[model samples]
Target: MPMSEQRYLVAARKYRPQLFRELVAQEHVTETLKNALRLDRIGHAYLFSGPRGVGKTTAARLLAKAINCQTPLDQREDGAEPCRRCEACLAFEEGRSLNVLEIDAASNNRVEDVRELRETVRIPPQGARKKVYIIDEVHMLSNAAFNALLKTLEEPPPHVLFIFATTEPHKVLPTILSRCQRFDFRRIPVENIVARLREVCAAEGVEADDESLMLLARKGDGALRDALSAFDQAVSLCGTRLRYAELAQALGVVDIDLYFQVTEHVRTGNGAGMLQLVERVVGAGYDLQEFVIGLAEHVRNLLVARTLPDLSLIEAGEATRRRYAQVAEAFTEADLLRMLGLLAEAETALKQSAHPRLRLELTLLRLASLPHAVDLRRVLEQLDRLAQSAPEAPAAASSSAAADPSRGRTAGLSRLSTPTGSTTPQPAAPGSNLGSGPFGPPALQVRPSEKPGDSLAQATQSAAALMVAEAPEASFETLVSRWADVVQQIKQVRIHVGLLLEESRPLRLMHDTLELAVPGEHAERLLRNQETFLITQLHAHLSEAISIRRIRFVVQDRSVAATSAALPEEPEDPLELLRRLQQQVPALQQLIDRFGCEPLWQGN
Candidate 1:
């Protein structure tokens, strides 16, 4: 706390690895070097490669001391161990080892430095086993320096060992790499980093919680020293125990609970709630990028928890993991995937964007409103629900086919077409009982969308409705395709609708008739709502003289969801499903007339 002691000691250096055993997440490098020393298979030159703060330089020094220790152990022969008590070890610890020469290749990267190094390697050791040269950041050495060092590296004296360490090993000459025994190091995993941080904290006598420790470990990003430095700051900032708020404020990280609340709101299709939460988060003055990263991570957790179902493997703490599990339970797998994709895209936007706040808010808004989007699954689920809840309106069915003149049913009402030239057939719902009991045979023949008794005049009315919904477009094909794309966009926000939409395929592109076939009648109602608006928009967007005369909703007899539950439960959004059906099938002019039942398909 004194003025002199107040000088900043970056987290990186304060916890720099001083001993081989102190190194984190580079056991392969350390163990291999220790083995070489123990086995006397020490190569003339060694290459240590990995990311920064991952012990490349530290490993180099440790190798140097082990090789040239004054009282070098037979440990490599015994078991790859270093003798810490020897004079050479003592000298190396003091940075005054006679035989161990450490060079920063960055500053001294000229040919002259290589020349001097070459001369030094030839003299052999005055007091150690070998004249060991340690070059840190050898990638920074000049081309000439590399070439000058190559020859000696190829055939150094038996008593000389060259150890080169580099964060960017690719920058080091290939010739240099090939000549040495390469040992690759990797960035420590978060778990390893946390363990190391705990060790450091214990040594420093700082009391810390798992959450705060995990935060520090994440901040380290595999760097033990960085985590320790952050730990030091956290300890200083909040004394012994670190509060989540203090950790967030000190680290510029958003509160985990904010992320929890926001993601929870998103799961339930609460756009207003999400917006309110976002306003609060932004008002807290948190960096938008940080929040974006956290949101992406939060979504990712939900995704993994939903799919994997193994909380132990996840990288969050118990509290965070529980929160993720709860959120994951609320969402379907597809929902989480869509949100994750959105968050990821938003992360990119945040990075490239100058206005992070705007990007963040927009991303949050997109996620919050995603449930309103149409998805194939949602559409399918809606169809299933409609089949379950809708009663057998036998008279309504007979009247429906009898009323539309341009429509007719064939093959026992398997297929139906309206008088407007729509040939889509409405299929029976998966578990809908056509007979006496649930899932029984067809007791009352489910009539098609078009009636056999529909006179020409009545057919004209049905056709007129279809034409009114269809707007003028340049090409019916383009209109329908673009409509499908919009439905797909809707699906991006609504997974259930997206699924059902995927099932409803377009059959025919008539002049004023768009023929679409769905798996069942439930899909018919789904296509009815946006049926008119989409037709209008299609005409407007393409500017063609194509009218969406009718969305022919024909059902396929086979139930896609039959393999699972007996009855399909209603999805959250049914209107989107109807739009999907209409977009997928333009010929089914009477989707609303057929499956537009109450409770399931809310008329929009």
Candidate 2:
């Protein structure tokens, strides 16, 4: 092939920024340089440092071209860009400029190289106004080389300018860094990279969609040169036209749809589907680590969608943004956070694991099987609803009692003793009738001729009924007296909270607030966490006598007295202990009767 036919430059080099204004995502560096030129405050030495392929070297070259251009500074476009038609700019463009020297510091990093550069720097410019020395990868220079160049860099000739480019400024000696005006470049944004890719595609006459261009930019991971390189490779592979699906497949990039499928499987708890997805990924030669990374980003986007009112934070096309919004509706932010955490762990593990495929499979399965997190707000809402419906129970009980005079007295007595919302059946007196009601145990009928003093049992029951029926308004004394029953009722609902309450005592009841003295801060925190539930239980048990709207737990230095003092003491004898347990827990008594249980004495 002829030399002219073979002269094809890569997109990265062919589309390199020729002017300061053309540099992408580097406004700070460009604006400062343009102002320096405009104000005639150009420094003797400049250091350009940033990540690889973020226009550090390209900016250096453009600065050199602009400084040596024949056009007057005030007459140049933007007062910074060089006129390509000028002799100095044309020489720089054709890589034949005598004034602008771009040195590869990586290859010439010895002290001898610095001596040679110093000798050359003393020479006057052959044709241009300034002698520009651009050292690429200046950090690769040896310590001796850096020291040798320091004096020249600090006190260069008035017509000479030095520009250094490096990915790592830290590796360069601090003394060398102090001699240069450093301008740190930043990674280009995805939007900016995509816009540049659009321009490149138009120039190359290649048809590409927004999604394909966005994917190419993301695959670049913030480097415009890298994205352009990818754009070249994509054009080569796809032959002048690029679609998202075909480009993703040809590049071995995991499709975004795969990430959505993983989330959908998690939502439905489809572990088998996740396994199948992993199989498909493996069979299709997708990189598990890259998939995990993309999945984490997907979950992060979902979280942003679920939390933020708009999808401004998410970087995707409008169609993909709408999909994220729809999928985010099915998951809470907490769930997405947990998924992201899991993916992060899996990502770390995948790098070190010998069996990455197996690890990925287990991770996906775990994600699918993740238990749905209970929302505390929803639980509180349900509790509020239950509380609102509780007061109606007493009225319904009273109405039933009025309709049946035979059982009216017993029903009224039972209602007075039983707490609202309690399902425990009240023990009946030697009854005339015991029919089961929707609430619990049916009301029992007392004989019309039975007297309160007829027997010891009857007299005790009559006195207890009278006390409960005429109970005084709630006070500190009343709370102390009823604390045992409150703890026992709590045990039926939440045993752990009941145990915590047993170690606490009622300190005082002021207005609607009940204060309890707890042993320590841990206990206080635990009790306070359940304070709302405790208040609900208290209301159910003492709404008729007390108006407890809040319960405050205090961590006091002094020991708290037990709240279960009202419980009967356990007898020493084994048989008596069993009998006491049976009396306290109705289920124990029922078990004993069902099994025909008998106490075994030591001799037996």
Q: Which ten contiguous residues of candidate 1 have the minimum total lDDT?
A: 408-417
lDDT by candidate, in order shown? 0.67, 0.79
Off by over 4 Å in 2: 1-6, 383-604
lDDT of 2 by residue, 1-604 (tens): 9887898999999999898889999999999999988888999999999999899989999888888888997788987788888988888999888888889999999999999999998899998788999999999999999999989999999999999999999999999989899999999888999999999888989999889998999989999989998988898899998999999999999999999999999887789899999999999998889999989999999999999988977888778999999999888777788898999999999999999999999999989877544433332343335334433333454466577767523334344445466443333343222222211232222344754333222322333343333232354566788899989999889876776677688987654678898765656877899988998998898776677878888877422223234445853677766676556444445456757987665844
lDDT (tens digit, per residue) of candidate 1 on 77-158:
3454456777777887777778877889889999998888777777868777888788888899989888988788898888
Give the local distance difference test score of model 1.
0.67
Candidate number with greatest TM-score: 2
In TM-score terms, candidate 1 sits at 0.64
Per-residue lDDT value at 153 in model 2? 91
Q: Give the distance in Å from residue 461's predicted Cα in candidate 2 to where it truly belongs.
A: 31
